[model samples]
Target chain A: MKAPCTVALDRTPLYDLHIASGAKMVPFAGYHMPVQFAAGVLKEHLHTRRQAGLFDVSHMGQLRLIGVNAAAALEALVPGDIQGLVPGAMRYTQFTGPSGGILDDLIVTKAQDHLYLVVNADRKAADLAHLRANLPRDIAVEPMEDRALIALQGPAAARVLERHAGGAAGLKFMSSAAMPVMGFACIVSRCGYTGEDGFEISVAGQDAPALAAALLDEAEVAPIGLGARDSLRLEAGLCLYGHDIDTTTSPVEAGLAWSIGKRRRAEGGFPGDAVIRRQIAQGVTRRRVGLRPDGRAPAREGTPIADKDGRNAGAVTSGGFAPTLGAPISMGYVRAELASIDTPLDLMVRGKAMAARVAAMPFTPARYHRG
Target chain B: MSETKFTEDHEWIRVDGDIATIGITDYAQEQLGDIVFVELPQTGDTIDQGGDVAIVESVKAASDIHAPVSGTVETVNDALVDEPGKANEDPEGDGWFFTVTLSDPAELDDLMDADTYKAFVAKL
Candidate 1:
């Protein structure tokens, strides 16, 4: 969630650790978070793909929906089949506005007694208000303000986490469990934003530093910062909250129709149900597609895109030099006709046209531990 | 005689005869993180002081390289096109962006020397 930096920023539980590790701190999502460590962004990104990287994601909001009717209440807001989520299973979904635009994307996990949610930091307050005003009165929305979230991601993440929590390595992807890590109670979810196989651990704020230090002590774990986190997720072809999917973009146009469960697709109870159903049936005028620029020059966010004939097509929402591919990669919305794979296009960078083309996403293949 | 000077934009210039070699300072490269691409000016291109001459791209963002003095581009470090990490490894030497034939040697007087540049960087 890349938001404008304001003067007053909060610090995460690991802020002192980041400073001690020589991290370059920057204001992010109302927090002074590390952008990169001494290893720099490139190395840190490559390392996470090969090994494991620990990220301080405490700035994100964690909340719980109590009462048995919570799942049904949330289903009224999103198109996902929240009621079908079995205990310990997680599902990725978005909060949609009445106009079919996405308010925010979040991960919801079904716990023993409540529905746990992890939402973007910048949108947390509004999300809370949305839940309180819309959800039924019996379903209580409790913010987990005392907790901190950290993600251990990459190929070696399972191994690093296994040393602390015995059962974590065995959990299947998109699953969660309450486990003890370094003797501290925590929620370990076998999932992450990076396309790599990993886990997100939620622990009490006070126990965060010790848990992070223990993970860093592992030979395979490196403390990754937000810079690598952004590039990694981009390479994974995942949509960032504000950049890729915002209030102006809908689930179908954003290429997120697959996230809408089959049951939810047939039943029309959620917000923007009619608009989403119409788009899903008739298709959207503009569709988000992955782009690969022909040259080494990076096409950043908001760069204008044109069709081969030089007509306006769309604008890049997220573009950067993918360290994994050694070339510039981007994701943007284009006219439905131009969204096909291999459709040639031009990216206007500084008034110069750079050759680009639509490509298949997950620019780097997703390596999820499905077992 | 060769003399080195620095600019507030974190660029360094080494004057040799009528040619001036330019590259970003180590601190600038550090601030930029890993340099992935360095767009160089073509030889014979004329530039004025403070003109946008090159573009240095890191994995996350791009930065403009402004000319510190007026000159005509002479030679560029073509190797940086494929191995831009050189800018991070040896920013002041092999990572030099381009060399230009100075239009006016007097422009050097307006730049900071090594000592002043170091002091200037310290305050930031």
Candidate 2:
């Protein structure tokens, strides 16, 4: 049967490889991405948790802010203390708007004389514009469009990486190093969105397909699609841009206050400093918490969360049937008083009130290797 | 024995003696992707024609399974409660949703026959 015609919204370096794998291509973030492969979504999700899964996240934006004033210039826009980011260390941070709402969450890695960053694929254009408009003239914001980002996540991810990239085994969680993989030099970071001990490889776009193929050749590595990626991240309590964290959610309300560096809070700089500092001091009214449904039914996004008296407490931002948990799990914003562990709650699913309870941030334990 | 008929919604029903076994077509299961959960009505519930009698949830979305003909539900496929993937694995056999006692077997004439269903699925 002829495959459906995929309009190339944008093509990654591994576009041909995805097509050969019988992937169902869908437009996402101005790029044609594989939503699912021939094995289907369920199998793909299961495979990733059991074994290593390679994901083509090339659609996400990669950039570098160069010059001596780069970190200082970046600190003006984000809540992170960029100046204190030691080289080879990565930090999860967010770009805040004027009113203290999050513009987008991004990973910032300090390289030699430059600040390497990765942002959400859908928010690339806006993020670039935000950087250009806010950054000082001395700092050069260079977009790394020639690079491709790939994630190898699962229990066997470290072993697969050690075999492909010689020095990858030495890297600890949230740390990165330049290593040679498949004869191509790339930056490998011991971090991932799946809450597993995984590595995200930033390689030249031209070398991405070969490296991806090499990783997939290993018995432990499988090609995961976006469908599984979403489910895995949801299970890990990681927020997705445009869904969980948006331009209206602040770091305090999103339960990401830890991302704000202690130095930044004490020094009191960055945009919306007054509002964010106040939230950190007094505590935010609403906080993001994990919810477990009492029944087998999944409480999907936008489901209304209710208190004991049936009053609207919050709304579900992300939810799905967690394959790992073997039950319905969800994450949503709830009143600060109701964000305690094991607090009883209810989810309004399809007009029917379903019993639920507020659990911890991650429904499953994160398996990232600290060492 | 009367001929089996199919609906555009992908439901199928075959009448043998006084009982009619109902299930979703293979094409329906394929379109729904991997079935993770199924909510079926109790065996004795009376369902009107075209009314929702069951729900099938896939990884991507959820859909309601409508009663193909007016009838009183006789027995449900209890196996589906444990293994919903049976719908994807065998939509026409072990994946049968429920059995119903037809209120009016004459209503079967309104459904499409096997050959017509074959052609109907071809268009999809």
Candidate 3:
């Protein structure tokens, strides 16, 4: 159709650079982002898996929680073991509602001085308000609006980063450190949404273009867009907030129990901890699972799922053509009894019953740098 | 070297007497991105001039292919069903959607020629 724009969208620091590189820009989460470049979505997706792909993730909200009790304050809101998080280590967790539903998915890193947090762009305003209202008046949630986030992901990402920032490759998975990226002071983390081993670099917004250009200059790196990011994360079995998970879905139901630390599950202090604990013990009616459609027809979001008798079972949340799998893969909530692997099901596409099966998640194996 | 008529909706039709071949324009394929699957109408089915006919599903979205003129469907491109990317590769040639027996050859006169269609797309 027409280019994806409906309202006044924001631009990232690399916006003009993307256009100069022939990227097809579109509206995404209130920002005008490149969905594909001249190489197209399919090509960009595969290149990221095989080598490396540079992505502009500056739209995400970066915040610094400054207080004497930052981790303790955040632990009251999230289920993750923030108190146990060592400085320079990041933990993935969701901000939950009083009823235990997910407010948003975020990554919180225990920086040297204060706690660093990166939240989804769409939920930043509300996330900030929620934090401010919940935490004591002493804790200040400072927004880093002047910062830009870029991800260099794939198998060769480490070597490329090693060339520019020699200290980046030394960090382990989910680890962060302040290093010089392309001669600019940046917080480089060995983490990314993609299943590939990579790093997410946070730097001053003005220095983003130089950092992005330096990464693009690497032989293994190519500038990618959001289109490939979605597919790559889908194959990684990662949940997309407001889609795969939301205020209606809980952590246990969404299969994110691991994110809730063992001590937090027992302590029972965070918001909605009671409801989540009950779901974990008694189990949930519906659970998120991976689905493999029988044919080439992709069962997109909102596609209905049916049982053997053609009775309505559930609906697809995130579905698309997974480039790595070479076929269509989807993740959605289904009846708990039917959430097990190899459970035969049907995805109703265009009034026809397309045979499907509940398969193991992370449709593509993760290549995270564990060391 | 050729004569093909186009509709404002972006379909391109090549007529040979009463039998006509229908497909989307190059511009249409470019906008649709990579075609993953296609649903074509059944053979022998009758369609109105402006009725919604087949469907083309790209990686991004699914778009309905409207009938350019009243006709009876004769055959579909099965090759496209197996390899949908062919539509992106050669949208004007081997990517033809279907063949139809025209109910009225006069409807073809109302369509825009190659040169007129090119200028019309420039306005968009």
Candidate 4:
């Protein structure tokens, strides 16, 4: 049977570059992105770990919230302590709905007199609407459509970036500052989805091609696609917006309560703060946990997890054959009572139940540079 | 020497006497990136001409390998279970999927030759 054809939504500045590099493009989150290149997913993933990999994350939504008290206005909607964030620092936070459910997870970085934010491409429209409806009239949520975002990730990522943007070597994790990349003004942050020591560079769309080319010129760097990106993040135990965490799942149950600042939790002003605070105080009915399947058969998404007595415990949210682990691994939400490290569980794969266990998050230890 | 034939479905069969070795084409492996697992029928299993006899799962998607010709499965490549990347590394050589004893040798004539398969892939 022929596979369904994907309609191109929008092309990044590096669209032609991707094709020239032998990338296999696919439609994802309303944009045409490279799924894999000639190197294959496993090789691309391993290469990223051993060195730096360039990812075209221009499909993600980039916005600049400009106002006198922009942080205060944003703090009203999100649970993170945005007001206390020092200039040139970033924080990972979530947009909360009126019902206390999460709208989307995003990155908020304090820039020069403005707040720079990056949101998921699939939920950009919804995120903007939510921000406008709740934010006061004084604040302006301007979408930076002319900017393209790229991620340079891995242990050697800093070396590659510093070669262009001098002084970036001093930036710590979750920090951002204006830097000249390939002679273009860019906001470089020490952050990324791969859980590696990396930087997310936001540059002008027109300059993206040159900057991408400059990074690729380095002998240590190669173009990574969405296929490898997903596997890398999965191994890092990072939550994907739509798959792992969604509007229906609360941040507490998703094991992201640490993202909520202590001051914000005490003040209790953000949307869904009451419900979330209660979940934190009492406890959630279920919690997200990682699983390691006993065999090579991958426990794919939607696979039902059962307890020892054949009781439905949970369902696999994301699962695959982890190349690093050399076996199948999965992540899913399970009953709170059974959410413990080394807890034995069973995954139903193709009618045969396979043994599994509830392991701690980050199947692979995150290599983010805190220094 | 007998000629090898290719199917539009991407399966290739090299017939030598009564035995034929079947595997996927290079174009097919490229389309299915990073093969992670393979499921093959055991020896002695019967399959129709167009019936599915094997399966291959990649990180991106899963695909069914249909039998190119009606035959009884004579052998399977057991080495593929632990090293599925062999299909990606050498799809036509070491990655040969399974061997079958052809039930009808005449069915081979209906398949495309290497030249025709090259043209078919070029159109895609």
* Best model number under lDDT: 1
lDDT of 3 by residue, A1-371 (tens): 36645589899999988999899988888988989888877889999999999999999999999998999999999999999988999999999999999999999999988999999999999999999999988999999999999999999999999999987888999999999977999999999988999999999999999889888988899999998999899999999999999999999999999999889989979899999999888999999999999998889888999988888889999998888877888889999999999999999987889999999989999999999
Model 2: what TM-score?
0.95
Q: Which residue runs of candidate 2 sit more than 4 Å off their true CA positions?
A: A1-8
Best by DockQ: 1
Q: Is candidate 1 or candidate 4 better by lDDT?
A: 1
Candidate ordering by lDDT (highest first):
1, 3, 4, 2
lDDT of 2 at B77: 92
Taking the tens digit of each residue's C-alpha lDDT, what string does model 2 give over A36-93?
A: 8888878887788888889999999999999888888899899987888789999999
Give the candidates in order of TM-score, highest first.
1, 3, 2, 4
Which regions of candidate 1 are displaced past 4 Å? Answer: A1-6
lDDT of each: 0.94, 0.89, 0.92, 0.90
Per-residue lDDT over A104-211 for candidate 1, one digit per residue giving the tens place of the 0 to 100 score: 999999999999999999999999999999999999999999999999999999998999999999999999999999899999999998999999999999999999
Task: In model 1, state the lDDT of residue A286.
Answer: 98
Model 1 pairs whose backbones collide: none
Measured over the true interface residues after superposition, the C-alpha RMSD of each candidate is 4.7, 3.9, 1.5, 1.9
Query: What TM-score does chain B alone reach in each candidate, compared with the true chain B?
Result: 0.98, 0.96, 0.96, 0.97
**Candidate 3 at residue A244, lDDT?**
98
| TM-score, model 3, chain B versus true chain B | 0.96
C-alpha lDDT of residue A54 in model 2: 92
